[model samples]
Target chain A: MVHLVIDGKGFQAEEGQNVLEVALENGIEIPHLCYHEQLSPYGGCRLCLVEITRGARTFLSTSCTYPCLEGLVVRTDTPDVLRARRLVLELLMPLAPEAPRLQALARQMGVTETRFASDEEVDDCIRCGLCIRACAELVGAEAITFSGRGERRKVEPPFGEEALNCIGCGACVFLCPTGCLHMEDQDGVRTLDKWKRTLSLKACASCGRRYLPFAQIEFARQKGEDPPAEGWFEFCPDCR
Target chain B: MGKQAIERIVEKYGSDHADVLEMLIDIQEKEHYLSRETLQYLSERLAVPLTRLYHMATFYEALSLKRRGRHQIHVCMGTACHVRGAARILEQLERCLSIKSGEVTPDLQFGLATVNCVGTCALGPVVSVDGEYHGHMSASKVERMLKRYSETEANGVAVCQK
Candidate 1:
């Protein structure tokens, strides 16, 4: 454990624990978008900017990526920190104006309007990369990716081709921060619109109702070496 | 032969994950571009995910996924080249090939693309074809330069037929 000072409050955090996690744990409440407990630190949002002081040198960094250390001093709401956070929010407003979380964060930060122009074609996506990270980290399926940069940026399959090795698990859809990705089931076919691919749903043997994509169950089976009995995965939880 | 060559590359690189980028560059050097099958093979041989290979393919400017044409045409769109009427030279090439930038001809004879800068700013209006730099390029010289390479190199196995 290491002792650190955040906003004049002293607290003990575990070794290598990031400042954002430490602050949130102690109720410091540093606003952030790209930081997720399950996924790795991306530091893409830039909203968790904080002023850190060590000995005599002082600098600003996104707290989510900055680890806590012994005798470290941090401030979450300094003038420079607020200035940088507000500008980042303002810049992001055009990208996801309709996202409720982003809008609420902007309002909380007193950012009512944006100085930059918005492109109507981008829809409501903040590009925090939660979906991509979740798919790659949790489900172990990288069905979609963030390609290009700036005006040419997009979240899609590489080379504009159909998703390769996608199991249609809907992990990306479930974890999307801005609700940009969509998944729907119809006539035993699972359609992940954002990924532009379709999957067949497995019907419960007893209930005759579709429960999950066949690929998801196949993916589960592939993870384990021992093969289960026949019809082992053919039933929903309720039927089982 | 192709699969063997890629396997040899992995063996040469010792399948180091950090050396994936270097391995990809070498494969691109041999295949001219990274094909899906080749990348998949590398992913398995290196014990890395295909997603990572695709990410690297997109991240680096040197690598390409599509099969490149026999003749490569890169027009420098840098500040120095732009000032020397590089746009006119690009326009001339596009007209000659009847294809837009970043596109290859149907016969796989030539590909037209642009670059930010080649660091040879002194050679303004520079255009490179198959790694041969042509400095001081002019719109009128586009046809003469293209005439140096004849057609019928590739069958365009994946050609579009109406």
Candidate 2:
């Protein structure tokens, strides 16, 4: 345990937790993104910046990445802290105008509208590095990596081809807070709600409900080929 | 295989929740589905509310409440699979089976469903027939696979034997 003074009130917190985590655990609200508990903190958004005073020196730092120390003095809701956070939100608005969470956060911070002109074109990723860190740190599959430099940077597999090593674990999909990365099945059937989709056999020409892979059938037809009869069976949905 | 053996096994375990799921899975594997008698026995032995047990069974993607066919065909729909014409394969299977994704035939020979990514993206379009992986597939290939399974059914043998 470590003793710390946050906004003139003394409190005890665990030794290793960062300032933002400790505050949140203690019910003190602080604005932040790109700081999910499941993933490593990138501190890229800079939204949870706070003013800290120890002895005579006072400095502004991101609360998400900073570790809690003994005898530390923290002030999260100061005027300078609010001003810096508001500016960070202002900068992010032009980049992602359509994001509802961002818009709501901006409104809460007392910003009526964005000061800068909206950049009409933008990709879904905010370049927060959550996916990259997860792949490297959690899943142990370095199949995906950030490519290019500066504004042209984006995540891609080797040689820009399909990721062969990807296990389809869907960890990256779940961890993405912005809902950018999307996944579907091999047959091109997509189900956002995992349990809703049903599995039934494709109908055979001969039998009414025999089991068959519909996507594979379509593929063979398009290529002007006939399916084999030995391994495959055709039936109707009911018969399958 | 006998009733006495099943009763002895059930008595030894006393039906913990996890054990209940495992037992249900084993029973389904042997009997093709959970029969009304089996469900009743499980409900009593496990001390689990019948309604709660039903809810859990239906909640998971892996479990099924209805009787299944002799063969199960699982199609992958992960992002990698979708981009490579997996949809076409599904359509072909639907046409061949004469049944939709979730329905079983009147004869109870096959069951089909679409699954989320199975972690084999290199084989963009992949299908699993009774847990066997078939990669780099097409619609025609799927039909051929089904034909083979039908032959096994005619022979009174399982198609997924390793």
Candidate 3:
């Protein structure tokens, strides 16, 4: 464990854990995007900027990628950090204007308007890359990816084509921060429109409730997952 | 990509995941762009996730996911160049080529792009074509420069005087 002071409050963090994880674990709020615990720390959003001090030297660093070190003094609520976070929020404001989470965060950060101009309407996909990371890290599908750069950057299947490697896990849907990845279940079919794939959901034998997507179950089975002794893919989580 | 090509890359890099970027660089240099097939091949051979590879590919300006042309034009848009009308030169190139900053010509002859800097601020508004630099570019010079490329392509001679 490494002892560090965040916002004048001393906390002990596990070795190799980042400052954002440490601060959030200790009930200290450091606003962030794209800092999922299951995925590797990608400091793309730059919202978790915090001031760190060690032996009279202080500088701003992204808390998500900055590892906790001994005798480090961290300040998440510094004016400079807040200012930087607000700037990032403003820069990202036009991209996901309709995202309620972004709106709430903007309100919390006291950012009313963005100085940047938007020539066209943009979707709620903030491009924080959570879904891409989740698909790669947790699900191991590596289905989605970001293509292009700068203003043309977007998350999509490779070359904007359909991804045959996708297993219909819905991990990306579950991990999306802005709720951009829409998953709809209708008539025993779950559709992930952006991925251009659909899957038939499995019904729970006990209650007839639609349970896991069949493709995800097949993926798990292919991974040599042990079936429950009571049944084989028949019961939902609740019924099981 | 063939399995043997991927195997060659893996063998050359000692199959270390840290060398994925270098391996990708080599592959892109040979293939011109990172095709999906190549990425998938590298993913299986290198044991690195495809999405991570894609992340790295998009993170670097040198790596391109789409097909490029035989000739690449990199326009410097650094502060010094920008003040000296780099945007105008880029706009002129886009108009002449009928392609955007990051797009390739339909004929696969030319690819236009902009860079932050090339550490040559002395030559503001600089453009590099096929690794050859042209300093102090103006919008009027774009047509003549492109014509030279077309002439070189047709005549089979390296006659780009600039």
Off by over 4 Å in 2: A118-120, A185-240, B1-162
TM-score of chain B of 3: 0.80
lDDT of 2: 0.68
Fnat (0 to 1) per candidate:
0.24, 0.00, 0.52
Candidate 3, overall lDDT?
0.83
TM-score of chain B of each: 0.84, 0.81, 0.80
- Tens digits of per-residue lDDT for model 1 on A87-134? 999988888878888888988999888898898576777778887888
Model 1 root-mean-square deviation: 4.5
lDDT of 2 by residue, B43-148 (tens): 6666654443454455445566677767888788889999888888888777777667877755688877888788999987998887888999888797778877
> What stretches of model 1 exceed 4 Å from their correct place?
A158-161, A204-208, A225-240, B96-98, B129-134, B140-162
Per-model C-alpha lDDT, please?
A: 0.83, 0.68, 0.83
Residue-by-residue lDDT tens digits, candidate 3, A1-240: 889999988898888999999988888898887898878999988889999998789999999999989999999887888998999999888777777888999999999999987547666777788988888778777788987677778888765666666878788888777888888888888888888877789999999988678777777767665543535678887887
What's the candidate order when arranged by decreasing lDDT?
1, 3, 2
Model 1 chain B: worst 10 consecutive residues (lDDT sum): B153-162
DockQ, ranked from best to worst: 3, 1, 2
